[model samples]
Target: MAVSAIATPVAASSGSFLISPNVGLMLWTLILFGISMFVLWKLAFPRISEALDRRQRAIEESIDAAERTREESRELLEEYRERLREARSQAEEIIERARRTAEVHERDTQAEAQARREQLMEQTRREIATETRRAIDEIRREVADLTVMATEKVTRKTLTEEDQRRLVEEALGELDFSALAPAREE
Candidate 1:
């Protein structure tokens, strides 16, 4: 019926009311638009705006939480890196200390070996000197015995112990026995 009423006016006017404006229709359209806008503002607009505000708050909170988490992770990474660097430095120090200890040990060992070798050489020299003195004494005794026997044969008689001793001493004094001994090294 309302469509017929609107159509009747267009039929009577013979010109479209959309082309030539109708004051009554324009007034009713304005009233209806205002009422609809008022209803939406009171009901739908508040709900939509509240939903949009909730979504914005949620997104901002999520972003802030993510930023905090990122900062914490960065700090943890830096701490891990620092610990690694300290570990590497400690390892290097340990290696260096070990090397120094080994070097010191080697030097001490070499010194001890050298000292032992020198001691052995000195002992050998002392033994050689003792043996040389013993041999010279034995040779002197043999020469003294031979001289007494030769004198007994030449004189056709045994001599007294005092005379034999004097002859052996004179013979020993005339002999240069130092050349027969081994040479000493400095």
Candidate 2:
């Protein structure tokens, strides 16, 4: 029995490296390995691979959605900037229009004031002319009365109406009206 066991070990070694002489054990091990591979291909491995593929697809969808969101945010930012620029332009235009309106109103106010001043000046001139004319007329009447009295005293008698009128006319012709009234400055 010991010699037979030794011969079997030698024959097994001569055949191949790491080979055993127990055929039944090797056959049983091969059958168990095959069953494990079939079970993995049909059930466990397929389920695990499906789970991994589903996770990969989900990741790809999430990345695509993130890219779309980024694009949309960029467009919105540009749109908001354009709106802000338009608002600023409108504000500047409004300010400019208000300034122009104020200038026109100021000019109109100045023109009205100038016209009123001119009207007041013209009225004053008319009043002064009327007063001057009245003064001159009063002086003429008093001078005529004095001349008539002087003549009557010199003659030692009251003169007739005709003689008084003739003497008053002579006095008025000798008087210079330009000397009594001053020239007006333009």
Candidate 3:
């Protein structure tokens, strides 16, 4: 019994909370602590936590910038569209003004041409009436001379001054001098 007690003194010490230096438990404890630290730093802390934080911040910034740019682009497009509409209205107004001016110009030119034609036609008619009157007078003088000669030949008698004048007047009474035809000089 005394020899068994001496041999089992190490076992008896194990029953206490203290451990011996001769056991390899210290090495196991160090290995487990190193592995837990490695897992925390390499897998848990750096990969999931920091990367998630960076990604979330980046996404938020990108969304904000995209919204601002979209608003700016929309405003610019609206401004350009307004300018286009204004230009179209201005162009239409210009065309209408030009059309009105052209119509006025055409009317003025046509009136001028019509006035000129009327003046020329009236002047030509007046000239024709004057020429007809002069021609009728000349023809009457020639016919009277021939009649006097014929009368002297046929009657074998010379007419007196009063009879010749009366005969010539009677012959001219049948003709209208105002409406006489133009004389052709032979």
Candidate 4:
């Protein structure tokens, strides 16, 4: 029994006293596994879960805010487009109205000018006709007197007043002077 005890294996040596046997290694492994489980349950698992939850909430909030901002911007763009269209229509209408007004004024001015020109022409024509009549009457009287005097000189006879008048009137009637005259004056 003493020899068998001496031959039995032992992890510790008589000279080196730092470690003992396989039981200590088993105890260390069990203790390390227990501590790892405690850390995961008490600190690591909860912190990881909390971080995941916070990240999910932040992503959701960001998406909602982005959607809201996009909608507001779209509405503003639509409003601006409508206003621009309305202003363009109004500007076109104003321009058309101004063009119509100018045409009307131009027509009125032309009509007035034509009427004034017609009036002036008519007045000038009347003055010309009056002057021509006066000229013809003066020429007729002078020619009548001249013809009577020439008859008296050629016949060498003193004629009666009625004879002289008739001869002079007949000679004046033979020469027509009424067809060659201007119808208007300046």
Candidate 3 lDDT: 0.82
RMSD (Å) per prediction: 7.1, 7.5, 11.2, 9.0
| Least accurate 10 contiguous residues by lDDT in model 3 | 14-23
- Model 1 pairs in collision: none
Work out candidate 4's RMSD over C-alphas: 9.0
- For model 4, the superposed segments whose C-alpha errors exceed 4 Å read 1-42, 125-186
Instruction: Please give, for residues 43-126, the per-residue lDDT of candidate 4 as tens digits.
Output: 999999999999999999999999999999999999999999999999999999999999999998999999989989888887
Compute the lDDT for candidate 4: 0.82
Sort order, lDDT high to low: 1, 2, 4, 3
lDDT of each: 0.90, 0.85, 0.82, 0.82
Compared with the true structure, model 4 gives a TM-score of 0.44
lDDT of 1 by residue, 107-176 (tens): 9999999999999998998898889989999999988998898999999899998999999999899988
User: Considering every candidate listed, which one attains the maximal TM-score?
Assistant: 1
Q: What local lDDT does model 2 show for residue 48?
A: 100
Candidate 3, 156: how far from true, in Å?
21
Question: Residue by residue across 62-120, what tens digits does model 3's lDDT show?
Answer: 99999999999999999999999999999999999999999999999999999999999
Q: Where is model 4 poorest over a 10-residue stretch in terms of lDDT?
A: 11-20
- C-alpha TM-scores of all predictions: 0.59, 0.55, 0.42, 0.44
Q: Give residue 76's lDDT in candidate 4 (0 to 100).
A: 93
